[model samples]
Structure formats: C-alpha cells, structure tokens
Target: MTERPSLKEMRAKALKNPEVKAEYDALASAFEMKRQMIALRKAAGLTQEEMAEKLGTKRSNISRLESMSASNSPSIATIENYARVLGYSLRVGFEPAAAR
Candidate 1:
C-alpha cells in the first residue's frame, strides 16, 4: 500500500484551487484568532474546565469559543471576558487591509 499524503501536502494541493484558496483566505482571521485563544489558555495554565469556571460558563462553551467552526461569532464582550479570565485585557485595533 502507498503512504497517504501528509496534511501539509494535501493542504498545499487543495490551496492550489482558486476557489479553495479564496475561501481559506476569507477564514484566515478566524483561524488565527482561535489559535491565539488556545495559546493564551495554555500560557495561563488553564484547562477548559478551569477557564469555564472563571468565566462562569460551561466547559463546552469554552471549547466552542476556541473552536474554528463555531456557528456563532463571539461578540467583543465575550472575547473581552475570555481575555479577562486569563488575566489579560483585550485590545482591538484596525490596520489598512493589505493589497491583494
């Protein structure tokens, strides 16, 4: 049997398609946000359960907040609360979009 392609290889191939690349680009910010949330939680040494307790929410809710495919986008207040629970203050800013 042949070895399967690695995820990186498969992703590179998939991203070759213009439509798939566009969709991926569209979701890049959301993906980056989720990644940063997970990193912050890890840096705070908090499990999902612990984070939920601090946030007065459920573990599942914390999981959803860190999930890339979460159906509802979290509001600024929600993000602020998450950061506050991790002993951080949230900051939001904007920069000019890069030319495509």
Candidate 2:
C-alpha cells in the first residue's frame, strides 16, 4: 500500500500554481468571513439550532449562511442580522491590496 500525501502537503503543492493561488486568494475573504461567523457563534455558546431560532430561520439556513461553499452569497442585511444575533455589529472596511 502506498502512503497518501497529507491534506496540508497537497494544499501547499496545489497553491504553488499561480492560477490556483490567484483563485484561492480571490475566495480568501469569503472563507475568512465564514470562519469568523462560526467562531462568533461558538463563542456566543449558540448551536446552529439556537442561532436559527434567534434569527427566526431554520437550522439549515443558519448552516448555509455559515458555509464556505454555499452557492448563494448572503446579502449585507443577512450578515448584519447574523452578527446582531451574536451580539456583534457588522463593520465593513477597505484596505490596500498587496502589490501583485
């Protein structure tokens, strides 16, 4: 039997490609937002079901909103609502991008 490369190793190799890296960089902000959303929910000690109840939505809806691979992008209002339920206020800001 052959040993398989670890996911971290595979990811590092894949990210070495300029095209793949570019695509990954483009999606970084969305991934970071989803991560922060999940973190906030956990820190607030709320399960998806609890979050759904607070938001007046279904558990599945909460799951989709926190998913990185969700097909539809959530609206700003939806994000604001999510943050509000977690005792947070949504704040969007701009920063200079790294020189390409």
Candidate 3:
C-alpha cells in the first residue's frame, strides 16, 4: 500500500505551484482590505453590528470582515455601496513610494 505524503511535504509542494502563489497574493489583499475596512468603521465610531446593518448586511458579516477574512471579498460595487451607507467617499488612486 502507498503511504500519504506528510504535512510538511504537502506544504512544500503547494508553495512551489504558481497557482498557489497567486491565491496567496489574493488572500493577502483580502486581509489588507479587511483591516482597512475595520479601521474605517472604528474611526466612524460605528459598531460592527451597526455598520453591518447600515451596510444592509448581517452583524456576522461585519464581524467576519473586521476579523481579516470576511468573504472572498465583496465586489467593488459592494464596497462602494458600503462607503455610501457609511456617508464616506470612496476614492481610488495609485502613487508610487518615494525613492530611498
């Protein structure tokens, strides 16, 4: 009978896959977005439940979002929707960092 690969071996093999790398990057972005959203909500002085209700979502959804993982991520339209509900403007910009 063939033996199954160990967890360490499985991790090494997965990390070498391009698809895995891409997925990791995507998850990283999701985590960052979640952090920013939670910070904004707090700055606005709104509780997760309050924000979720204002955003037309459930409190659990807000909790998940604030916890650095909510959905794969809400769509851009969803994000705009949330911003609008929070009475804040959503701006998108791209600026490179200054040279060292």
Candidate 4:
C-alpha cells in the first residue's frame, strides 16, 4: 500500500479518526461560544469595562471570556449572571428541531 508523507498529510489523515473529529467538534463549539459572548456584549452597547461592572468582574476578566485561546473560561454561572444583568436569558437547544 502507498504511504502519505509530510506533517500536513498526516494531520489530514488524523482528521478522519473519530477521536480527532470529536476533538475538533468540541474546539469548534468552544470558539462559537466565545464568538457569541463577544457579539452579545457588542449588541448590548457595553464596553468591556461596563459589562465587567455589570457582572461584578474586572475588564480583563471580561476580555478573557471573549478569547478562545485563553487558558481560563468563564463559568457557565458567570455567563448566566451576565445575561441576567443585561435582562437576557441564556437558552440552549438542539439545532434543526422537529415540530412538536
């Protein structure tokens, strides 16, 4: 059988592995959440400092929450608190739901 060479090709092969696919899926979801948080903060017309004050946190903390590469993620409870402070509620549901 033929063999594939180079790191890029090996990485591409790894993507076909179930474990690798699952890891990618999880990472994508995490990034999406960070994006959503950033969008929400913008839509509320709140500076990071303003949002931090409303959340009882520091601006840096709010900054970190919007960063996917950050080592720390804000707790779900903290996100819920921020949503509540902005008079919004967090909702999670399956996508492409069928009619009830």
Between prediction 3 and prediction 4, the one with superior TM-score is 4
Against the true structure, what is each candidate's TM-score? 0.91, 0.93, 0.54, 0.64
Clash number for each model:
0, 0, 0, 0
lDDT of 3 by residue, 1-100 (tens): 9999999899789989989967766576557766777777888899988888787889987676566534365667777876777676677666564353
Worst 10 residues of 3 by lDDT: 65-74
Ten contiguous residues minimizing lDDT sum, candidate 4: 91-100
Write model 4 residue lDDT over 1-100, tens digit each, in one string. Answer: 8775999888889999989967776688678877877887889899999998987889998888778778977677887887787777887666663343
Q: What is the lDDT of residue 70 in candidate 2?
A: 86
- Please list all clashing residue pairs in model 2, or write none if there are none: none
Scored by Cα lDDT, where does model 3 land? 0.74
RMSD to true structure for each model, in Å: 1.3, 1.1, 7.2, 6.9
Candidate 3 Cα outliers beyond 4 Å, as residue runs: 1-26, 92-100
Model 2 CA deviation exceeding 4 Å by range: none
Candidate 4, residue 10: Cα displacement in angstroms equals 16
Stretches of candidate 1 off by over 4 Å are: 98-100
The candidate scoring highest on TM-score is 2
Q: Which candidate achieves the best lDDT against the true structure?
A: 2
lDDT of each: 0.91, 0.95, 0.74, 0.81
lDDT of 4 at 76: 77
